[model samples]
Structures are given as C-alpha cells and as structure tokens.
Target: MSKEWFPLIDEDKCIGCLACYNKCEHGVYDVENGRPVVVYREGCIDGCHGCGNLCPEGAIIYSGEYKEHIKCSCGCSD
Candidate 1:
C-alpha cells in the first residue's frame, strides 16, 4: 500500500453506488449514507485502479502519478 495512492470520490458525480465499495479488496473504502468513502487511504495498493475501473459513474479518481508499468486487465503491461 502507498500513502500517495487512494481513490477520491466526487460526490456530485457519485450516485451513491457501491461499486467502489464492493470492488476494493484492500479495505480502502467504506459506505456512509449509501456512498463510498476512502476511509483507509493508506490501504490502497500502489498503482491499483480496480475500484475506479469498476465505478460506472466515473466518480472515483486516483491520486499519485500514473504508472504505465502496471498491467492492464488484458494482461498487457505497457
């Protein structure tokens, strides 16, 4: 987990969907009033965007510099 890596949810864009909450396996998110919050930011994995990818409303945006070395869902690391 990286301290600089975490998901930032845009409340205006969020529809209170639990997509991010259910997608995160690192205990990085928590539900409050039906919306997902980044309660455990330090728990977020470095270069991991699983939660953001699963968000339908594109409400989740990750911090830190984008890493191109990480592998994609298609198994391509570019």
Candidate 2:
C-alpha cells in the first residue's frame, strides 16, 4: 500500500512563528517549548502537503505520523 505524509517540527529550528499553525487547515500543528509541534499529526491529511512548505524556518516535514513516527502500526491489509 502507498504510504502517507505526516507532520513534523524541529524544536531547535522552529522560531515559534505560528505561521505554520495559522496556515494548517487540519489543526495538526501546535506550540510547545517555544516551538511549533505537530500535535494532531495522525489526524492530519493522509496526503497532507500544505504545512511543511509554508514554514519559514523549515521545521515541518512530511514523513510518517509526526515525521518522527518511525515505527509501523499503519493498520493496513496484507
């Protein structure tokens, strides 16, 4: 099956601009530790491609579930 894009944020790089938070329609990004964090990542778009591009600090990434989600529990069919 085809994988999907997830949200991610780099704490060190994030400038806490909230630009990404304001732009995202999915409500996936949030503020934490003075940085934008991908909180509701799994509920984010399965094909979401809008958040990462707008980040001025380039803190966002589309990888798995929250970009850091490296483990596989995708509930897919065999």
Candidate 3:
C-alpha cells in the first residue's frame, strides 16, 4: 500500500502564482479558477514534499512526514 500523504493548500496564503502547480511533476495539483487544487492526491509520492518546499508563497502543507508515526516500528519516541 502507498503511504498516506497529500498536500494541503492555504487559500488565504496562496497568491495564485502557480508555482506549486508548475513544480509538481507527479500531477498532484491542478489549476482551478486561478487557484491550485489537489486533483490527484494518490499521485503524490511518499515522503516527497517538492510542491510544498517549492511554493513561493509558502501555502503548501505536506502531511506525509507526520503520518510516518502511524507506521513507525522503531520505539524511538517512547
């Protein structure tokens, strides 16, 4: 199974720059009404935050890394 991960866009922070849409090579985002939207959540690769890291407005939020806790087998946090 693929790891649970997706990008969340902050509408207020997004400037419609299309930076995130242009940076994503996995077809994870789409431009709708001049705004970015996650059209293919499953297309996003696990542990990949390229879109979020490339957002010029810092509007993209990646939840992949945090979700790793659910599958972690190492008892490092205890």
Between prediction 1 and prediction 2, the one with superior lDDT is 1
Candidate 3 Cα errors over 4 Å, as ranges: 1-3, 64-78
What clash count goes with each model? Answer: 0, 0, 0
Give each model a TM-score. 0.78, 0.63, 0.74
Q: Cα lDDT of model 1 overall?
A: 0.75
How would you encode candidate 2's per-residue C-alpha lDDT over 1-78 as one tens digit per residue? Answer: 343566667777878888778777666777776667777765565645556666787887667543333332222111
Name the lDDT of candidate 3: 0.74
lDDT of model 1, residue 18:
94
Off by over 4 Å in 1: 66-78
The candidate with the higher lDDT, 2 or 3, is 3
Question: For residues 2-62, what per-residue lDDT tens digits would candidate 3 score against the true structure?
Answer: 5468788999999999987887777888999998899898877665667777778899887
| Model 1 lDDT tens row, 1-78 | 347666899999999879888877778889888778889987766677787777898998878764443453422122
